[model samples]
Target: MSTNKAIFTMKLEPELRDSFMAAAAAADRPASQVVRELMRDYIERQRQADEYREYLSHKVQRARAQRDAGDFATNADVEAQAAARRETLLKQAKEAGV
Candidate 1:
């Protein structure tokens, strides 16, 4: 851990703050350490969520371009393909006694 530090202050219900501090003490760790871990975890999760959103946005853009170029399958066409695949799988499953 880095020694560089700054104070962060926030207001919460006194009872909640007291309980959190007591829990930290019971676990033999400082409240600051627990708070820092929580903050870091939250930040990483937010970053991952943002990256996923960006990926989905790009996928949507690509799909839209494909649609515009008349290069994508229609919903009915996709459903028909899926139905054929399902039938083949069901037959295989029956043969395998699965």
Candidate 2:
């Protein structure tokens, strides 16, 4: 972890600020630690969401390119193949008593 640190200041309603401090004290954790954890979690979630959006965008572009090139599988065809694979896997698992 980096040793660098910065101070963040914000104004909050007195009631909300007191409630947050009380909750933090009840949990036996410093308010700063809880705020840091919440900030980290929020940042990580946003990062993951952005990554997933990029992944989907790429997939859509690829699918469009394939369609334009007349080299694409129909939804029904893909579903049928997936179902067949699932059946084969199930059969193998049954044979293995899995």
Candidate 3:
């Protein structure tokens, strides 16, 4: 055990407390360790969620800028280009008998 430690108190429902105690006893470890590990996992998940929110915000801003600058293709333009490519691919596939 480390000499550096902090003291804190937690209030748990009876059922939850019993479950924690049972798990600790089964593992031959302190309940505090299980609680600490659960807390650490929760904090890491929250941090990842925050990072993903920031990434999505940046992507939305970039998309808004592109739309305002008219740097986009119309649906018809995209469909026409895709159709042409599809025709070429189909021709190649037919030639290859695939």
Best by lDDT: 2
TM-score of 3: 0.85
Report every candidate's CA lDDT. 0.98, 0.98, 0.95
Give the best candidate by TM-score: 3
Question: How well is each residue in 1-98 modelled by candidate 2, as lDDT tens digits?
Answer: 99999999999999999999999999999999999999999999999999999999999999999999999888999999999999999999999999
Error of 3 at 52 (Å): 0.4
- Scored against the true structure, residue 22 in model 2 reaches a CA lDDT of 100
Between 1 and 3, whose TM-score is larger? 3
In model 1, pairs of residues that clash are none
Clashes of each: 0, 0, 0
Q: Candidate 3 on 10-96: residue-level lDDT in tens?
A: 888999999879989999989889888999999999999999999999999999999999999999999999999999999999999
Using lDDT, rank the candidates from best to worst.
Answer: 2, 1, 3
